[model samples]
Target: MRTLHIITGLGIGGAEQQLRLMLRHLPTSSSVVTLTNPGPVARGIEADGVPVIHLGMAGNRDLGALPRLTRLVRQGRYDLVHTHLYRACLYGRIAARLAGVRPVIATEHSLGDAQIEGRPLTSGARALYLAGERLGTSTVAVSPSVARRLEEWGVRRSRIHVVPNGIEVARFAFDPAARRAAREQLGLAPDAFVVGGVGRLAVGKRFDRLVRAVAALPDARLLLVGEGDQREELLRTAGECGAADRVLLSGRCEDPPPAGAAPDTLTLPSLLAAMDVFVSTSPDEAFGLAVVEALAAGLPVLYVACPAVDDLPPGSAPGARRIGPSVPELTAALREVRRAGGARLPQPAAVRRYDIAAGARQLMSLYENAVHGTPLPHEVSCS
Candidate 1:
């Protein structure tokens, strides 16, 4: 079936990369519309042979964008309209209804208890979200925890469907040669204990806590992937802790280049291979895609909150350990990990449970059911 996907921006964030990865596996025809910045992930999507259209939305209150989007939706003759991110969901849902599209789906990618897309939620924001939510056929939550959060926010549980975020497990398979090359490339000594964290450097992510924790360990080197508003702040924190030389803020890591393309820089998987351990200090996360990816890479992980692992049965992810959010707690945990030494663990069963191919299949079923006016399932099993 023909589908039209709408999103706020196409940057190198988890949700943006997840969209590109999902399109790669789904068998149906699809196109993308980004409301603003058509950044690197957009380029990757286009390279993957999907048509991407950039909607020049000036800002949140741009009324002109409404008619423009409605017209585009009508002209595309799309069988289904799916949206990602908050702004896109708010606008795309209204536009789809205006265009007479009965089947509209929106994936709530980053919904926390008090924040949506890293912005604090106000009453107006909640009202707007609920108004738009009513126009869609179903709202897909990236995790069961997010679904529960939606229910607590007054959304009908019947309209919330759990479809956890997924990953390409094989792409993250640990490689010894890649590990050696990536270490040399990053100027890391072969025997250095590398501690890695991947996510936007935002306040809510609590990367400052990670910086402090790693700084306390003299022998540990911190490798932080992804950029955000907190770059300068994190560097300053590292400097204050006397670990300025130990922290490496590698800017955004792009997806793997298309097949046969000459590799220009280190891919995410290559960077993962260079790491000895992966740590996520974020106390709040919707699905914790980064933690799952670390598991796929066979890196021992320490996270504060990860619904992807927490919702599953015990032992699903043997390498992952939950810790408190305090700096001292993180410091103590790192000490224990260091005492045990660095050894790559086996890829756990949890990694396979969130396979991208499986999620795509489950999503395809939801699309068919929505278009045919069938009752949506409460949860689409990714495992």
Candidate 2:
């Protein structure tokens, strides 16, 4: 079945990266439409040869975009329309309905109790989301916790599908050569202890807490991937913690996405291999895709927010430490992980469970079922 995927913007984050990765694996014809700014990830998607249409909506309240999107949806003649993020969900759902598309599905990539649609929920935001939600045929929650959050937010329980975010596990596999190369590229010493984290450097991620934690570790250096509005603030916070010299703030790690039949991916794994331990300081996360990528890279982890790891069976995240959202806790975890070190990167069972190959197949099957008006595959319960 032909599918059209719509997202709010094409930037470097879990949702954007996940879309590119999923496209590499799914065995169906698909195209992408970004509602606003077509940034580097848009280039990556185009490099991968998937047609990307940029709907030049000036801002969130561009009501003119609705009819334009509706016209595009009608002309695409797609069997299914899939939406992601908040604005796309709202606009795409309406456009899909306007185009007479029957099975409009949305993927809820980054919903947390702490925020809604990348903004703190104001007086009537939840009410607005619920109204937008009703136009979709179904919604895909990235984790069980996100599913629960959606239920609490008044999304009908019957319309939610739990499909965790996944990664190309083999691509993230640890490599000794990669470790050395990445270290050399980043000017890291041959034997220096490193702690790394990857995500948008937003306030909610609590990266400031990481700067504080690193201040307590004299020898352990920090490598943070992803960029955001908090870059300047985080630089100042690192300075305040006296860890400015030891921190490396690498902006968005853009790797070429796959196109056509040749899906040669980029090398975020190499950077991951250079790190001794991975940490997540997010206050709350829906599925925590970066942590999974770290696990696939075989990095021992210390995390404050990862439902994807915590919800797994006991002993899943073996040798990984779980710490609270405090400076002292993170400091101790970093020190301990550094002290008890080597590349003893123990990948959790959860890593295997969220492999992108499996997830892509499941999603493709779900799309087929949606178009045919059948239930989701027996493996995934639609309700």
The estimated TM-scores of all candidates read 0.97, 0.95
Residue pairs in clash, model 2: 48-259
lDDT of 2 at 287: 84
> How well does candidate 2 score on lDDT at residue 105?
88
Predicted candidate 1 versus true structure: per-residue lDDT over 232-340, tens digit per residue: 9999999999999999999988775545556647888889999988999988888999999999999999999999999999999999999999999998998888899
lDDT at residue 381 of model 1 (Cα atoms): 29
Q: Model 1: runs farther than 4 Å from truth?
A: 258-261, 374-383
Encode model 2's per-residue lDDT on 189-264: one tens digit a residue. 9898888988888888898889888878888898998889999998898888888999998777774333332332
CA lDDT of every candidate: 0.91, 0.84
User: How far in Å is the alpha carbon of 199 misplaced in model 2?
Assistant: 1.0
Deviation (Å) of 47 in candidate 1? 0.5
